[model samples]
Target: MDWKSFMEGSKDLSVFALALRAVILYIALIIATRMMGHRQVGILSGHNYLVAAGIVSLAAIRMLNPESSLTSGIVIVFVYAFVNVLLSYLDIKWPKAIDRKPTILMKGGMFLRENMLDCHVTLDNLLGQLRLKGAPNLSEIDSIVLEPYGKISVIKKPEALPLTRKQMNLPPKMVALPTILIYDGKIDEMNLHQMGLDHEWLITRLREKGIMNLKDVFLAMLEANGTVYVSV
Candidate 1:
């Protein structure tokens, strides 16, 4: 129960020791994350995920087993991290060395059965995935490639593409980016100042919109084109 008992590698780890171990593991993981330079959770490849899972498992062992050395666990983490960094560098130099290229799952409205089978992806699952990727109609899709990171890339047929403004011979219009001027009935003075406007102008706009009490207005937005949208 005491610090001395915990430090002596006592068989029963006290709650304090466990908490301290947890903090150490947290910091270790943070350092590992920084070393890996991978910020996005979903962007890691399957192999990277396995490495991450292994590091977590080691951290778990340190937390669960009083006999397990925290120093050893942390060293293992850095070892994994170093190997990962080395492999990543090699991967950049030689792309196919670590991860395979994207697999063509479908082409010209026909499924690549061999690739799908190799990936262990069922036909129904592929169909559902395609739908989720915004290709609901298989007939409209020109191709579908399974990316190395496990995402499906959908390519629609040129004929199935939506009509564009240029195609219609229409003049290009400037798209307005709306800024929040009022949120939850509170004036965003910072945003107002940023937009080169003042409180009096906002009140005048509110008066024009018949919004007497700022508290009654739920949300208000100002667009780059000087358009104001108010929601009460």
Candidate 2:
């Protein structure tokens, strides 16, 4: 269709009218996210992102089908609301694991170049972030961390020696694994059955926290410390 035709509005919305709808939807999203009381900054999951993609996609479809109802728009809003809830709940329950906490990127000025490469951070970026935290010299900084929240932190060194894993003959590398006890607000039955894990054990644990059903939880994971954390 021509641009002019699209720009025109009838009782059925044209492109210009749809553009107005888009604007209003965006405003509403901002309000919804703010009300949800989670950090609006940092890397968000694709499912959790609160953009107008669904509305934008449905815009043309609605334009073509004048009889289209507001049901699709409402469904999109619900989708975002659900995702936003899941993210917020997960972050709150596992603040250390889910949210960005500073991981030691550099210690004792020895240069943990390997870790920097793994986390996809650069030396220059690390230096800039450290400078913001008043780290004037590499010698003065005890540790530099690339936080998961896309921020860097610098800690000034005290009069202490650095610990070397090689010097101590520890493992060369660490691999952190996430426990998959819960998915989509439901307990993974197959995982529990194969692992010989007990649902009753989990239920008792949750009861101590006043949580009742597995379905009420959005995410759950077991830490290396042998604790099961659940989020709703």
Candidate 3:
């Protein structure tokens, strides 16, 4: 039998069963996506979006597979992981092949029609994005970049703006990497390593505060300037 017949022949659920499957699939997708990290959802970069699409696509396939049982769903998660690894390897080996670099529609106040056409962007759509940024008149814009994810980012001319940074009084710059020390009562060892501290350091500090277990700490961070903050 063909794939369709095969699917129908196997896991052929009643209408109620299909409804139950749909509900379960929805919840599973949400949890799976959350575990996958922030890059899995929201506005994704080209590289990330491709992977996200593949993951969701496979998950959908398995969810809809008539042959797919509860076990099949579990297997599909593995399939998603395998596909990610394989694609990642291919992307690293020949970065150019799978990566479609976005074209610049506008730069230095000059419009590049050829590039815009290649990106499948038109003037009206370009102006809409610009107008959203309160630049109804495109002449007030300095540059517009058509990012790979089909986002139109516009930077208005510096002179066009009325406020100066000095007047705003922004800070010098403080960079902090907020690491999750405990997620669902578990310590993130990789993040701790990236922060140049051993598990001993984390435990030592927390112990000083009368917290003996990593599970007691909800979040932690090491600022670029060498300061550790913990949250329970």
Best by TM-score: 1
TM-score to true structure, per model: 0.78, 0.47, 0.53
Off by over 4 Å in 3: 1-16, 47-70, 85-98, 165-232
Lowest lDDT 10-mer window, candidate 2? 1-10
Among all windows of 10 consecutive residues in model 3, the one with the lowest summed lDDT is 1-10
Q: Which residue window of length 10 is worst by lDDT in model 1? A: 1-10
Candidate 2 off by > 4 Å: 1-16, 41-74, 95-101, 159-232
Candidate 1 residue-wise lDDT, 1-232, digit = tens: 5656554356778777877877887799888879988622557776677788898888887778877777777888899888888777777798787867899999998888999999988888888987787778988999999988888899999999999999999988778689999999999989899889998999999999998999998899987677999999
TM-score of 3: 0.53
The lDDT of each candidate is 0.83, 0.64, 0.67
Better of 1 and 2 by TM-score: 1
Instruction: Encode model 2's per-residue lDDT on 55-110: one tens digit a residue.
Output: 44555565455345444554665566666667768877986665556567888777
Q: Please state the error at residue 168 of candidate 1 in Å.
A: 2.6
